[model samples]
Target: MPLHHYLIVAAALFCTGLAIAITKRHFIGILLGIELMLNAVNINLVAFSRHDPEKLSGQLFALFVIVVAAAEVTVALAIILRVYGRYNTVDPDEVNDLKK
Candidate 1:
């Protein structure tokens, strides 16, 4: 496939993820959107790096992004679980009043 095709797909993914992250009120739904956006970024990184014959920077960056994303998910989920235990809910909007 061509580079433009990859870029287009990445753009679509980013847009969809952005919309989901903005519209979703659930913590898990927001996390899903963040993951989607990260994946889209990885696609773009790898696609652009494919043109370089001497360096693998793009792929390496994508790998780093994956690692970071994993760590972020771990920490975020832990926090969410803790909050759920205390509040019994995962809705972001409903959990705003933290003075309980």
Candidate 2:
């Protein structure tokens, strides 16, 4: 595929992910949106790597991003589980623990 095509796909995925993150009210939904955004970034990195075969930095960074995202999801889900246990809901508006 062309570079522009890859970039456009990446841009679309990023925009959709942003919209989901902004509009979703549930904690898990927000997490899914974040994963989507991260995947979009990975797509871009891989596409760039393919276009420039001389350097593997983009692919390396993409791998790092995937590892980080996995760790983030693990921790975030744990926290979300605790929050749900405490509040019985995952809606962002329902979380008032820090309202003081």
Candidate 3:
């Protein structure tokens, strides 16, 4: 309801997303974490948009973010699929061909 409440929710979502990204081993799991973080950002954007009745910039920005996130996921998944085809696994640690 209040701005502080929205901020707290955003913080909690960000923390959860961060924890997931840090602990996940699989590529898809990490993508899910990123999606969570993106959703948190969207929530914050919309919350701020509600406070500003004159301009809709925050809402517009959130829309652009959603579009960009969709494109990113599409490209990222394609790359992951190719990597899996080569490595036979999606584990981040297992795909170490670039390791020195």
Best by TM-score: 1
Per-candidate clashes come to: 0, 0, 0
The parts of candidate 3 lying over 4 Å away from their true place are: 98-100
TM-score rank, highest first?
1, 2, 3
Q: Write the per-residue lDDT of candidate 1 for residues 8-57, one digit (tens) a residue.
A: 99999999999999999999999999999999999999998986757899
Tens-digit per-residue lDDT, 9-39, candidate 2: 9999999999999999998889988999999
lDDT score for candidate 3 against the true structure: 0.89
Cα-based lDDT at residue 66, candidate 3: 100
Write down the TM-score for model 3: 0.93
TM-score of each: 0.96, 0.95, 0.93
- Order of candidates by lDDT, top first? 1, 2, 3
Query: In candidate 3, which residue pairs clash?
Result: none
Model 1: lDDT of residue 53:
50
Q: Report lDDT (Cα) of residue 94, candidate 3.
A: 84
